[model samples]
Target: MTQPRAVYIHVPFCAHRCGYCDFTLIAGRDDLAGAYLDALQAEIERSPLTEPLDTLFLGGGTPTQLDEPHLQRLLDLLRSAFRFSPDIEFNVEANPDGLTDAKLDALANAGVKRLSLGVQSFDDRFLSVLERRHSSESAIEAFGRCRSRFPDVSLDLIFAVPGQTLADWQHDLQTAIALQPNQVSTYGLTFEKGTTFWTRREKGQLDQADDSLERSMYGAAMDQLAAAGFEHYEISSFARPGFRCRHNQVYWNGGEYLGFGPGAASFDGGVRWQNHRSTTTWIRKVLAGEDAIGDREQLDPEASAREHLILGLRQIEGLNVAAFETQTGFALEPLGGEALSRLQDQSLLELTDDTLRLTREGRFFYDTVAADLV
Candidate 1:
């Protein structure tokens, strides 16, 4: 197998857990960070990483949750494992409340060029509802600080939040654009199972925006952001020219990547595997010189081809007809011609000589389109 061109290191430490988050994380257990780093080093040392990496991403409960020294150490350890492309887009997830000047300095010194801040909203009421620790003012300050040192800064926002109105979403988008971020990713809030928000919703303690309102809010983002000269590069992502999140594109484009740390997943040699979700279990296994992988799936060629088609369609570019055949050794139309015709008849899909792209309405029903095509 070829060497991975991208890497993702998960740092599952959070100062405080948000009510809506279902990510693999252990909030308020900052005390265990050192042990986690040690395990990370062990995993790194055991892996092979002789080729240069094009992109590197640090995601977690919050990578910025680590103290300066620990953060520095973690960055150094990961950097040492791979040869980096001269212009590697190394991104780290950060929160406004936990990013200190010292941490910024450390990140800069370690060659981190991108900061993807979790500024979920600029509305104080929404922030409180989401249980975020940072206020609107603080999040704005954090973006300013990140821009001072980083060449590329991205912001993550959520729309269709409970009790959110179209006006509220418009204001949030306006506020985000005024900040002039290199890129913005807008996601509709999801109440995943096991999250506090999910439990509250089930108990009728919390409510979600109506489906029609949710769709309208999303459509508004696409329209408003486009008017502001942002490229809707992906379904949920907008970027100023040349400012796309290359690291995430690696995943969206189905590029192979290695993942490290607890709850991280790696795809290599046609097999996808995940690490132990429990930090303690992952750390103990790594320290004991044992495999920390908990489960894996070896996908067959047909299954892999289907996945490629679905994942590729998620992008605005959709799937290139010729390239699809080259990659999967199966003509896409031959495989799903009937389904494609059905979607086209509904005006949800269109074919442009070589590219099969989603129409404007299809963007909202991408999941259905994906299922049908696959």
Candidate 2:
């Protein structure tokens, strides 16, 4: 098998857990980080690579939450495991408050070319409601500091909170564009099953934005960002001329990638698996020279084909019918030709010769379109 060209390292330490976050992590558990890194080292060395990785992404909990010494040591362990090209796109996710100048220096020294700052909103009220530690002023300040160190900086924003207004969303968009970031990812706030936000909503302690209002905000975001000269590359992502996220593209294209740390998932060949989510379990398995995978599955041919079509449509350029056939070994007609034709007639999808893509309305209801194909 060919070596995967990308790797994602999960840093599972956070100073505090936000209300809506359900990601695998241990809040306020710095002491467990050393053992976590040791387990990470073993996981990285499990499958030695003969070539350098093209892209490396350090994702969270909050990668920047690691203290100075632990941060450097984590980088050292990764460097020993895989060779990185001089021009590799090394990206790291950081919280606005913890990304101090010293942390920025450490990341730069470790060859981070891009920074994804979690600047969820420019509204202080919303930040407090979301349980985020940083203020709007501090978020912008962190962006300025990161901008000085990294070549490409991407900001993450959330919209459609329960009390958010259309004008509030517009202001957030205006403020974000003024920062002149290389990329922006605007996501609607979601209440996952296990998150605090979800439980509160279940008990009438919290509420969510209505569907109509949420849809309006999403549509406004697309138009506003486009007017600002950013390419609407993906549903939630907009980028400057040449600053698309390479690592994320790998997954969207169904390419293979290896991931490390608890709750991290890996896809190779036709199989997908995730490591144990518990920190203790992952550490014990790695230290004992045992596999850390908590679950695994082999995707069948039919399932794989459907996934390709599902993921492929996410790109702004859509799926080229001919290229899709070549890559997945199945023509579009055999898979979803009838549904596609009907949707196109309904003005939800468009088929231009060999290109199959979502129309403007279809992009808004993408989940329905994808479901129809299956």
Instruction: List per-candidate RMSD values in Å.
Output: 1.1, 1.2
Per-residue lDDT tens digits for candidate 1, residues 1-374, read: 58898999999999888999989899989999899999998898898788899999999989999998899889888777778899999999999987899999999888999999999999999999999999999999989999999999999999988888999999999999999999989999999998999999999999999889999999999998899889997889999999999988877777799999999999874789999998889999999999899989998878788888888888887888898889888887777779988998999888897998889999999889988876
Worst 10 residues of 2 by lDDT: 331-340
Cα lDDT for residue 243, model 1? 92
Worst 10-residue lDDT window, candidate 1:
246-255
TM-score between candidate 2 and the true structure: 0.97
State the lDDT of candidate 2 residue by residue for 1-374, as single tens digits. Answer: 69898999999999998999989998999999889998898888787877789999999899999998899999888777889987899999999977778889989998999999999999998898888999999999999999998999999999988788999999999999999999999999999999999999999988899989989999999999999999988878999999999999998888999999999999995999999998888899999999899999898877888898888788877888898888888878878868878988889888897898888888788889889887
Error of 2 at 198 (Å): 0.8
User: After best superposition, candidate 2 residue 94: deviation in angstroms?
Assistant: 0.6
TM-score for each of the candidates: 0.98, 0.97
